[model samples]
Target: MILPCTSAAQDGWLRLRQALWPDCPEAEHLAEMAGFLREPDKYAQFVAYDEDGQAAGFAEAALRTDYVNGTETSPVAFLEGIYVAPQQRRQGWGRALVDAVTAWARTRGCRELASDALLDNVASHLMHRALGFEETERVVFFRKELS
Candidate 1:
């Protein structure tokens, strides 16, 4: 089952997020989850649970008025992150979590939903394609330090 995240689910959500993005500090996940729980209308997080009530995956999304790649509409529903536990993948949990986000975005009057993944992440690329997202474009980013 899919459900909107609440304060009571924060700890579990944090754990799953940490597992997904292992290099990120736990504090960062906590802070970001807090923001979503505080203002659900602009930012939302949904959890997918198995029959035993364990969290299997999660999806975080937000309304982005800024330029969203491949989307012509403003105020696009942007998927910030999504992850399904390795043990729980390929069972439709990921799709269910995304569907929840899609419903939420439509209710928020959004005309588009956008998401991106690292160029080298093949799993993410295939997942997006399976979920009906078309490839927009790809470009490597560069940064230079200033004195």
Candidate 2:
């Protein structure tokens, strides 16, 4: 079953978030999730639970007013991240989480939903395609520092 992440489920969500982004500091994860807990309308996270009431996956999404790739509408629903346990993948949990986010976005009057994955993550690319996202463009970013 998919349900909105509650304040009481912060630790569960943290575990899933760390699994998806191991490089991110635990403190950073807590700070970010704290923002979600404070603002339910603009930010949202959903957790998928198994029959035994254990978290199996999660999706974090938000409303983005900035320019979003492949989107022609403003204030799009942007999927910040999603992860399903290796054992839970291919079982429709991921899709259900996305569906929940989509429903939430619709309630917020967003006309489109957008997401992105790293250039080298082929599995993520394929997953996005399976989730009905079409490729709009690919970009390789560069930066220069000046003092």
Candidate 3:
């Protein structure tokens, strides 16, 4: 089953988020999760659970009024992250999570959904395609720091 992330206290959501972004500290994750939870109009997250009631995957999305690389809409729904436990992959969890995000975006009047993956993450690219996302453009961002 797929459920909306209504609380930052949901352990399953925290665990799956940590799995997807292991390098982030637990405190940082909690802080960000709290921030997201506070902004229901701008952010949405969903967690997928197996029949055994264990977290199998999760997806996070944000409504961005700022320019999103491939979308023409002003407030595009941008998928921030998604992950399915290795053992639970290919079991429809990812698709269900995206479906939840899609429904949430529509309610907010978003006309398009956009997402990105590292240039080398072929698996994510394929998954996006399978979920009905069309490739719009490829971009390489550059940054410089002045000391």
Best candidate per TM-score, number?
3
Across 1-147, the per-residue lDDT of candidate 1 in tens digits comes to 898888835536888888878998877877777877788789988888899988899999999988887889999999999999989999999899889999999999998889999999999899889988888988788999998
Model 1 residue 76 lDDT? 95
Candidate 3 lDDT tens digits, 1-147: 999999997648999899989999999999999999999999999988899999899999999988889788888999999999999999898899999999999999989999999989999999999999998888889999999
Q: Could you tell me every candidate's TM-score relative to the true structure?
A: 0.93, 0.93, 0.97
C-alpha lDDT (0 to 100) for residue 144 of candidate 3 = 100
The stretch of ten residues in a row with the least summed lDDT in candidate 2 is 3-12
Off by over 4 Å in 3: none
Candidates in descending lDDT order? 3, 2, 1
> In candidate 1, what residue range of length 10 has the lowest lDDT sum?
6-15
TM-score of 2: 0.93
User: Against the true structure, whose lDDT is highest?
Assistant: 3
Enumerate residue pairs that collide in model 2.
none
List the candidate 1 regions with Cα displacement exceeding 4 Å. Answer: none
TM-score of 1: 0.93
Q: Considering lDDT, which of the candidate structures 2 and 3 is the better prediction for this target?
A: 3
